[model samples]
Target chain A: MEASTSRLERDYRRVLRLLPAGYRRQWGDDMVGALLDAEQSAAAASAADEGPERQAEERDIALLQRPPLREVAGVAALAVRLHLASPSTAGATAAARLRGDAVRRVALVGLLAAAGPALLSAVTGLYWPVPPELEALGHTRVDALASALLALVAVAAFALFVTGRHRTASVLAVFAVVPDLRHPLETLASAWRVSPGTLLGAACWLLVLLAPLVALLAWRSDAPRPSRRWLLALPVVAALGWVPWLLWRATGALVAPDAAGSLALGAAACAVVALRRSDASWMRTAAVLAAVGGLGSLGQLSLLGYPPGLERDLGWTALGTVLLAAAVGVVAGVTGRRWSAQAAPTAVTAPDRSASDASA
Target chain B: MALTEPAVLVLTALVGETRHGYALIAGVEELSEGRTRLSVGTLYGLLDRLSSEGLIALDREERHQGRTRRYYRLTDDGAAALEAEAQRLAHLARAASARLRTARAV
Candidate 1:
């Protein structure tokens, strides 16, 4: 009985080891005691009800030197709960006031950058000689309406982003990505006979859709709102994004699908600015998001046999974003102390105390 | 703050008197009619959060048979909060009963 009890104790400790060191130090022995107490009571009840043979079998199973999967899962859930719980440290406090900061400037810039594709698509989709089947939805009219909606959503996102409503802008941006996301996916999936060009186009479109979403996530609710003077850049964005790009792209045989990459570039640039600021922990998160996005897009691109033009187009612009993301990611990783140690939430210089330090 | 079911159960477990971790777990199981069983890690995490939020306080500690035992009880604030939650549940129950009575009459 003593040997079985010791073996069970070892197994319980092994399971309890899943908790953070600080937490274990505070309540480890007490917790073990509680567990043993419960187990002993359960054993007593089972012994009373069941036969001796069942009790011996149960003791053998319990002493088998293994913690149950339920116990392991419970510990994992506890870890998650511990991670999500707010720390007592002041450094980890939420920054809700960044709502009215320079994040708006970046979001506005991204909106303007994104506006180009819609304008280009709307205009060029008009003059381009699409096949009879391509014109099924009244050709240019339906195309124009879709572009207008995309541009509208982008503008609305910019407005909300600048006005200190990051979450609302994020939601709007998510809606905006739907059309972009659907277009390429549908184009690629429309037929059993898929072409290399269509695959590249789909990848490109997917990248475009993901850029704004990643940007909005990076900027999030923590970014400061933009300055009013920065609002003057709207006219430039309008002219460059909508007017000229549309005219230029529409006039060509090939449509320049550049807006999503441009938006991602803008997003990465914003992340850089966020990282340089004094209150930049959230900015660090933004940088990491951009890095993950860049890597993910690259992974998607790697899976496809991209055409030569697309290979060149994606390699430079998309890869440029990745490089920028890497730069920020490396800096954030190297310099950030709180990000790593926050999992085991305790002061770095805190003196170790025994569990006997508890107050009644 | 709106208490989760587990938080409510923990509060209920401590209502009678200060209880150590094992006793509290047993009390919660008994009170909840054996429907709820909190693991040690989960219970401690909840207790930490509750203590941090000032809903519960450490009452006493004792060493029994080479094992350390820490006891906890609800604070005044916790008692008041629990009372408020009980009233809210009662109100909801009364409303449900009224609806059932109306249905039966129809």
Candidate 2:
């Protein structure tokens, strides 16, 4: 009986660890003690009617059946109750919430809406030839110049739309990605021998239809006051993802390059965005490493087939390398800054408690 | 068969009379011959679930032995459930005993 009581006490004590750190610090031991005392009293009363030896064996069996410490359901229920019971820790930022909701809704709708028309135009075989005046000037050069200009415009529109509530800019950004999205559908249709133009058109129509809904959500939302630096990181990350894709389009035929670098850069940029939004250091670090490795490999490969005696290719390679390195440094610095901001105060609070204890 | 040990004991404890939290805990402990003892939190959590399911109803609130307590009484559904479970267990025990006797004779 005594042995079983001791085992039950140990089990209960272990379970008490699931309580919040603050709650455990205050009342864990007391709760465990109360549970043990109750168990002991119950055992004593039960022992009165049973044979002494049988009672001891029964107690042993009962102790063996003690529940495990990690009760997932219990902890989940407690966590939900705690969260609902507590007031919003982010404080009175209803305006910020509204703004954030608006931006998120706009981005979601724009992305969903653009998916269709882009695919349709691609499928319908709408070949966008270089303008006649530009064609007379030089077909390849004019095409490249047109593409570069469109890329710049798209990037600018995306930046403006993300940074401020400019409805026109947002709409333009949505249209800008339309051409790019259509390119994939066109290729798919040509290969599969099926018409995907209607599907693409429908998708674009849906996006256009949903524009008002996105705008309304954005307008109605209380603008969330996330750190401006963190907010700025979003566009930077998006631009980083865009650069490799643009580069691929420009140099894909000439370079016949592996897509490994672009994938690495995109993943790294996503990690930076995620790190800024959440407290995940490992993912941020992984993103940085993947970006660096991918860019370094691509830069190395780009230099391999350079024309003899023309160091110009080397210069471009060096420039690309430098840009990639700069991106890694920027993302790491942001991640470090965010981590330190959250970590420093928690470190300082520990020593003050010991000093107070000594004084008491 | 689905009734948890705690739920069954709780229902058995309230078989004849309504009981509050502290009394229910005590009664369950006594009825189980102290084989199963539930903490106050566990008891309350189970009671809340049972009440929500309509198997048990809050009967009354009164001061008992200096502590305010809310008494719970099993519904007809709960009693019927307990009876069904008891019969199932009894049937299983009888079958097992018969099997053991047959094995010993063989």
Winner by lDDT: 1
- Number of colliding residue pairs in each model: 8, 18
Cα lDDT tens digits, model 1, A276-300, are 6533544544553454445544533
Question: What digit string (tens of lDDT, one per residue) describes model 2 on residues A1-360?
Answer: 134355665676566565445434433443444343345445555786778886666555545445434333443343223222211211112222322342343343233223222232232223464556856777665455555556555445444544554466556665675665564455545645644543443343333333323433333112332233433544444444444457658865222112223323443554555576664333343344444334434334334356743344443544454456456656656675676456442211001111211112
In terms of TM-score, which candidate is strongest?
A: 1
RMSD of 1: 8.6
**Model 1 chain B lowest lDDT segment of ten:** B45-54
Score chain A of each prediction against the true chain A by TM-score and list the results: 0.47, 0.29
- The lowest-lDDT stretch of 10 consecutive residues in candidate 2 chain A is A348-357
- Each prediction's TM-score versus the true structure: 0.59, 0.31
Q: Among all windows of ten consecutive residues in candidate 1 chain A, which has the lowest summed lDDT?
A: A89-98
